[model samples]
Target: MLDKHQAVQSHQKKSSRQKLAKVLLATLPMLTVLGATAGLSSCGFQLRGYDTPMLFDIAKTAVIIEDNRTAFPLKLPLTRRLEALGLDVIDNMTLADIANNSNNVGADPIAAITVNNIRFKRYELVGVLTEIRLVLSADVSYQTIENGKPVTLSNPIQVERSYQYNEASVSTDDQQGNQIRDWLYDTLARRITDQYVAISLPKVAPASANKSSQTLKSPEKTTVIVPSS
Candidate 1:
């Protein structure tokens, strides 16, 4: 009878120990979470900014075809946008430079672009060239290094924008035109970057590897729609 009572007591003690251990084990995670929360709140730290470099194949070269005519304002904005996105822009390099120049005879290139046209249509005041209509067009040619060879990937991205002006609101016209151009440049930049990275970069190893939702970034320049002048 005594032995039975002792065994029962022993089992009860064992069960109590197990329950306490489980409670402790569960408390550990909660304690850890609380500690992290406390530490963050105490520090008062805040996230400021982020960086996302443009993705490309391991090693791909790029060249930009320069626009000779300086009368139009397109290439500069486009080039700036590309550079900001961390692309290897082939500046001061021409199609003749690639084809005619012996230096670029054999190169593993990624992409190239030429500003086919950047014109300002003169919307005349009573048949006079008074108001300017801004239009920008480009031809994008891309190639990728595949199995030790350069494969041509021709993807032309063309965008046109126009603005009507009133002599009374010259400042407004200038501001509106700039905003429109900036937006167009940013859109084109992203399109080209995605294409280049998808084609050139390895599928498994993407340029942007972070799975976080914060990878994609908004353009630096914001466009505010202005009332037509």
Candidate 2:
């Protein structure tokens, strides 16, 4: 009786093994079909598209900060953004510096952006423990030579933000305000970048409707027109 029971138990174990093997064999084709996708997911693959725009790839750009105290810090972030587009960030200090950078890269600057005339305004709020509104405006322009003509381009950007504040949390409110200011400055920089990437090379140096956003070329004495589009 004991030998018969042992034989029966061994048979059951073998059957279980055979079932698992059959299941694996049945799914082998499906697993093979998903092997590549599974490998990508296991390796943490992400499908982010190209970082630089087609027109701005490997182009040289310069960010020139004017004497506006409020806008001085805007140059750094704008330069960083431009460099992220695969542009070579070169200093535009003097002719010698420009020549050195150009010689090293064997290319002239595709565009030169000048930022100035920054304005900041704070409206008086009726309640101190309520919301405060801040406005930031900047004048940005890029000068580029196209078809042997000096062309200057400008775009208008102004960032406004409001946040709730409490007098009890003075430190927190102050910190929040600083962060908001930084964000505003970054927004202004990003707008200039968008304008450059979106607009094609200007054919006749057309300015915008707002004169404050117009950039005039100093390298040549020529006429500049306006274009809203």
Candidate 3:
């Protein structure tokens, strides 16, 4: 009886140790996974090519207008609208201001810019058993940043958008075409403006220590535009 009791006690101790070991082995992988997830969350990674504001945040700004490939001209429309959105509005800001191919020559810092879209569409009627209709289209490529270097937030340069006109809705073909073009122009302008301002946050400039930096020289400066009471 004494021998049996001793044997029983030893078996129970062995069983308990084994159970503990099993539990530890099961929990170790889960703990490791949790720790890895927490580490990534703390890092706060942002997606590549999400549009962030350039103005107010970045000191200098430049806009680049590519040559129009489409038959219809949208340059004037884009320029007027973008200027109203609060860009510096410099005419022919040198390529250096926009982007620098050579790092040594131009001192101008490159500015973040975006090209929204370019599109051309044509409607055609074809004979396939019964008059089949086909629409051929080409869309402008939109991109968030230029050059291989990442923008402040790695905003992408090009994204896809769709614009379509239905001749069935309008009485005149000219009216339909005009409406579609207007819609496309307006949409493209707003998209560029929204993305440009989205990532930028306001920053206050620190006061300069040098007296020369603080002062602006103006010999012929006169102001007389007070509202009359």
Where is model 1 poorest over a 10-residue stretch in terms of lDDT? 44-53
Best by TM-score: 2
Clashes in candidate 1: how many?
1
Candidate 1 segments exceeding 4 Å error: 1-55, 58-60, 70-87, 95-115, 118-135, 160-175, 205-229
Model 2, backbone clash pairs (residues 3+ apart or across chains), number = 0
lDDT of each: 0.54, 0.67, 0.48
Q: What is the TM-score of each candidate against the true structure?
A: 0.43, 0.55, 0.38
Local accuracy of candidate 2 as per-residue lDDT tens digits, 1-229: 9999999999999999999999999999999857744543334222234222244432566667775568777878888766655566665664345435545654555556767688888865757676779899877776665654557777767889998777676465477788989988898888887786555332322224233334343345679898889
For candidate 3, report its TM-score. 0.38
Q: Score candidate 2 by TM-score against the native.
A: 0.55
lDDT of 1 by residue, 1-229 (tens): 9999999999999999999999999999999977755544343222223133324443324445444553234455555544544455666666655444434646444455544433333333332324555544455666545675547676656555655555564464467666766666656656665565556554343324443333455435668998998
Model 2 stretches astray by more than 4 angstroms: 1-53, 67-69, 94-110, 168-173, 200-229
Give lDDT: candidate 1, residue 80: 52
TM-score winner between candidates 1 and 3: 1
Off by more than 4 A, model 3: 1-55, 69-72, 91-97, 101-110, 114-117, 121-173, 202-229
Q: Compared with the true structure, what per-residue lDDT tens digits does model 3 show for residues 1-229?
A: 9999999999999999999999999999999977754543344222233232224433344555555655234455555544544444443654554545326465544454534344454444433322222222223222223343435443323223333434444453545455655665555555555565554433323334233344655345689998999
- Comparing 1 and 2 on lDDT, the stronger one: 2
Deviation in Å, model 2, residue 133 alpha carbon: 1.2
| Candidate 2 whole-model C-alpha lDDT, 0 to 1 | 0.67
- Candidate 3, residue 189: the lDDT equals 54
